[model samples]
Structures are given as structure tokens and as C-alpha cells.
Target: LHISSSWVRDSRFWKLVDQPAPKLESFSFVMERECDVEDNLTVLPRIFQDDMPKLRNLALVNVSSWPHNRFANLTRFSLEHQPPHIRPTFPEFLAFLAASPKLQELVL
Candidate 1:
């Protein structure tokens, strides 16, 4: 699933991404605009918590914070254009990396 829109900053859009989809493997969420307080955005989890076993590639564009969670099968992950104010701290980013044991390619 590829979602590229400013609307992705809305948490409701994340609910759609969180829904169980057995065939979901690769997910790319792009937000054309940076989120602000008016957006009422919160830290979003990686999206696939216990589901999406086959998920391998994940990408987030112009996002805020990503929760630290393990995606055991994930291979490729990318994050782009996160503003310093909303970007994950080094420790948080490191925790995310530690979680994805199979991660091979990473783009920041």
C-alpha cells in the first residue's frame, strides 16, 4: 500500500493503515506537508504491530515520531524529511533499529 498525501498527517488515516490486511507486505506513507499542532497528530506506531507477518519494506515521509516496535520480518525501511523539532531522538531511532533484526537497507 502506498499513501502519498498531506492527509496522512491525520491519525484517522493511520487507522486505515492499522487495519488487518493479510496480504500487506510493503507500505509507504508519504505526507507532502509537515504536521503541526493544528493537525493534532500524535506519535504513530510502525502500523503493523502483531499483524502483517509478510511485511518487508516500510517507508515514511515527513512524519513525526515513530514508536519503537519490532518488525521481525522487515528488511527495508526509510524515513525522509522529518523536521528537527518533530524528528525522533537518536536513542529512539536506535531503539527502532534494534527492533528490526532483519533490517538490511535503511534510508534516513
Candidate 2:
């Protein structure tokens, strides 16, 4: 399920995210914006703290901060087009992967 739109209001987006997706297996989120504007969007840690145990494929594009821990059962993960300032450090990225023992493919 791909969701694409122009200038989605922040409240509307978060409202959709706040809903529970219990059986979700794969999720990819892309926030389209002009390159010149700063991308300050953040994914809170609790977004995936529960109800995503079956998630296998996860990808995030143009995201600023990803602070979730729902990759324990993921098989494929990708993070792309992130802003320089909000990107995670190499060590932090490694630690995030370390928690995903079942991960088979990774793209940073």
C-alpha cells in the first residue's frame, strides 16, 4: 500500500500512524519534499515498540530521525535519502542492526 500526496498536513499523517496495525508485515514510508527545505520529520521510538512483531520488510526514505526498535524479526531493511544532520551514526546503525538477528538484507 503506497501512500503519496502533496503537502500532507502533519496532524493527518500522525493520526494515521497512531492507529494500530497489528498484522502489518512490510512498511515503507516516504516523505516527498523539495531538497532545499529541511526535513525535520522524526519517527518516535514507540511507534514500533509493539504491534509490529511480524514486520519483515521496512524502508524509510527522506526521513530525518528514526528512533524505533521494531526490527527484531525483519528480513530486509533500508534507509535512504536522510538528512545529514539527523542521520544515525555508524555505531548506532550497527547497534540497530545487531538487534535484528533475522535481518538478511540491509541498505543504508
Candidate 3:
């Protein structure tokens, strides 16, 4: 299980990388705060699209700007570490969580 934050910061690269991570079981993204952030999904399409097969847990600790829209098969998650100034939309976050097919628990 591995959790990671921070997208590569390049939508082109994200799109390229997003298609071949099915082996990744556990994933997370404190989706690092970079100097700039445009479209979180357009850049990194979440961190659990194909990451399954071995994934059962997750830990996404990103800021509110990030569009949390995917995390499947996560039996456990630690989606916290929110900064005081961050205010992510629960609906988007929930939508992302809904992407998970095996998510059973979460810890924020």
C-alpha cells in the first residue's frame, strides 16, 4: 500500500500516467500544493482510476482546490491533514470517493 500527494503538475503527463496504474493498490495524494493549480482532475484525474487489484486503503490529504473525484476499492482511508485555509467541497470529495469500488472505511 502506498499513498502519495501532489500531482506531477502536468495535465499531459497526468493523462499519460493515469492510464497505466492498475497495479497500484493503495494510493493517496496530499496532492502537494504547487505554485499553481488549475484543473486538479485535468492534471491528475485522481489517484485511483486503475489502481486496484491490490489496493484496499487510501490517504488523500490534499487541499480543497483539488478535485477529489476518484478512489475505488478503498477499504480504509486517511483523508485528512487539511490546512486551516483549505475548504474543499464535500460533494466533489464525495464524488471522488464514490469512484472507489472497494472502499469500506476512511480515516481523516
Candidate 1's error at 94, in angstroms?
1.9
lDDT of 3 by residue, 1-108 (tens): 342445556565456445646677655555555424443422234543554556665665554444334444567767564553454568856675667656677565
TM-score of each: 0.76, 0.78, 0.49
Candidate-wise lDDT, in order: 0.73, 0.70, 0.53
Model 3 misplaced stretches (Cα beyond 4 Å): 1-19, 30-45, 48-54, 65-69, 93-101
Query: How much is the lDDT of residue 66 in candidate 2?
Result: 70
Candidate 2, poorest ten consecutive residues by summed lDDT: 40-49
Q: Highest lDDT among the candidates is held by which one?
A: 1
**Candidate achieving the largest TM-score:** 2
User: What is the C-alpha lDDT profile of model 2 across 11-97, one tens digit per residue?
Assistant: 776676666767888878776754445644544444543667788888776667674665788899888877677777899888887
Better of 1 and 3 by lDDT: 1
Judged by TM-score relative to the true structure, which candidate is superior, 2 or 3? 2
lDDT of 1 by residue, 67-108 (tens): 455677889999876666777678877777888899999998
